[model samples]
Target: MTDVAVPPPAPTTQTRARAEVAVAGVRVAPPVRRQAGAGPSDDGHVRLDGRGAALPLDPSSPFEVVDGRLLRDGDDVGLEVEAVDRPRFYDLATADGVPYEQLARLHGTDVLASTVIQTCIRYGEDDRCRFCAIESSLRAGATTRVKTPPQLAEVAEAAVRLDGVRQVVLTTGTTATPDRGARYLARCVAAIRRAVPGLPVQVQCEPPDDLAVLSELSMVGATSIGIHVESLDDEVRRRWMPGKAHVPLDDYWRAWDAAVRTFGRNQVSTYLLVGLGEDPDELVAGASELVARGVYPFVVPFRPLVGTLAADHPAPDPAVLAEVTERVAAVLRAAGMRGADQGAGCAACGACSVLSTAGG
Candidate 1:
């Protein structure tokens, strides 16, 4: 298939600025910073044009947030920027005395997110995903090893009551169980649903040996699910995520199909990390394929986070990242799959990726 080019949008638009900030990050220190954990972008959470954006807080970047506007080289860039205030829920603690902040942290402005299990079985140097720092926050004592269901329920209730958190994201490190941690996520989802009644929650994990676990999560009121396969290229998967690569692309496809059936179309999403050495055309083609299968392919840039194997790796060129986002976003728009319609999750939150900015 001949790949059609999606011309880069004009640089004067906020889409261009959003792409730049997503990759290059910004220079100012925001009130809520995600220094490291569970995912690729360790960033400062802010509202860019009143939408959530997780941008790297790099002291060296040319972009800076000044007085509610994004400035480039000390000049206004025509985009609004503001810090996301630390949530009121962070001030409270459980009866057992675990700080609510340690249990679940606010993502963007109102999304409550937690790594239910902090330690992944693939933590050994040889097996770790080069782009992931899932355990870094745990080792740094920023979060707990395991968040109990009741504890999560308590935190969920407080976040909703104290801060009006609209959605919750529950992600876990890959466990040894056949369900690969989905069952525990289901338990957490059930407990949180009971606590908040109609709150939307999204559960994320690796593809489980038992696909039934997907249905189990859905039955418990999980509004969405992320079965994140960072790269679709087998060679890139092996090179970047050696341990998770062993699961095979077929397993991921099966799980995604099952999830789309259970969670419904756009509710099933995956992370496609740019700059993992996958060909840009191939990456865009893979994203189009995902959309065809009723999955939302969340396109995000690769961040070389501290403590990960790829810590020193350079980020993808902003141009390349922007083009990929634009192309995939065109596919999403054609399929009528806006991330917001996913109900809840990373895609729904739209903080870490530029797809939302591109009208995905």
Candidate 2:
């Protein structure tokens, strides 16, 4: 894979600049400050979502230990963790013996996200995506096995009412059905909207075998959609997400086109992780292609979170990430697309990607 080095920008006059940067697609306050020198140690730590302390990851932390850096693009921007108080609904339980937290988690200050189905068809060791920890929380008794539609609706209502959640994100584990879990997500979206009308919601799933599933999601009040084709390189797909690789890149393109048609241009997006050994030039080129198609290519760094196969792997060099982000940001800028403009989804949430900091 070829590496493209981006020349560092000229130093700003101020020691600190307050900017709204997106992570996973949500805009948050980032205090961009000038560093005296360049190195991993020079990359200071900040809280994830602005609620926690700026604790450096211990060498033994469950998060991936990549040259002593935490995954999820820690160096790209500074975070001001918003103190998200636990919602009052968390103390209540559904009639069917489920906890609200099991269905959805509060993201940043206002977004609610759920792994609608906790088990993935490709979750076995031989086939699972190395970067996914989808079932780890379930196995550890941290979440319920599967969340019912009613359960999601009930929780969504409570989150919005109690915690002032403004948007919802529904993602599912790939199911055996031909829709590959889009059906479940659509149902969840419908139920949530019915419970709380006009709530902007986003649904994430593997590209369904039937493109019509996207329309179903849109009709159910899914204002945005994420068809995550984590990487564009076939070899990287095979190495990182073996089970998903069988689906073919053509299917993903078709799905993206159909999603844009149904949801409109920037309303459709895909997650493009920057590490994974894909050539940086190819990654940028692939992002440009997606932008041309009117699909937002959300470029994020690969985070080797705890319990995932890649936890011990190293993140891409921070300099490499800065280069990739700047390049992709240029493409998004040309398209007049910003993550916050999407209204909802990971791009709208903006905790995972630094491209938002670059004005993507």
Query: Each model's TM-score, in the order given?
Result: 0.97, 0.81
Model 1 C-alpha lDDT per residue in residues 223-278, reported as the tens digit of each score: 99999999999999999999999998999999999999998989999999999999
User: What are the per-residue Cα lDDT tens digits for candidate 2 across 35-70?
Assistant: 111001111123343322112223433232133223
Best by lDDT: 1
Model 1, 7: alpha-carbon shift in Å?
7.2
- All models: lDDT? 0.90, 0.70
Candidate RMSDs in Å, in order, are 1.6, 8.0
Native-structure RMSD, model 2 = 8.0
How many pairs collide in each candidate, listed in order?
0, 20
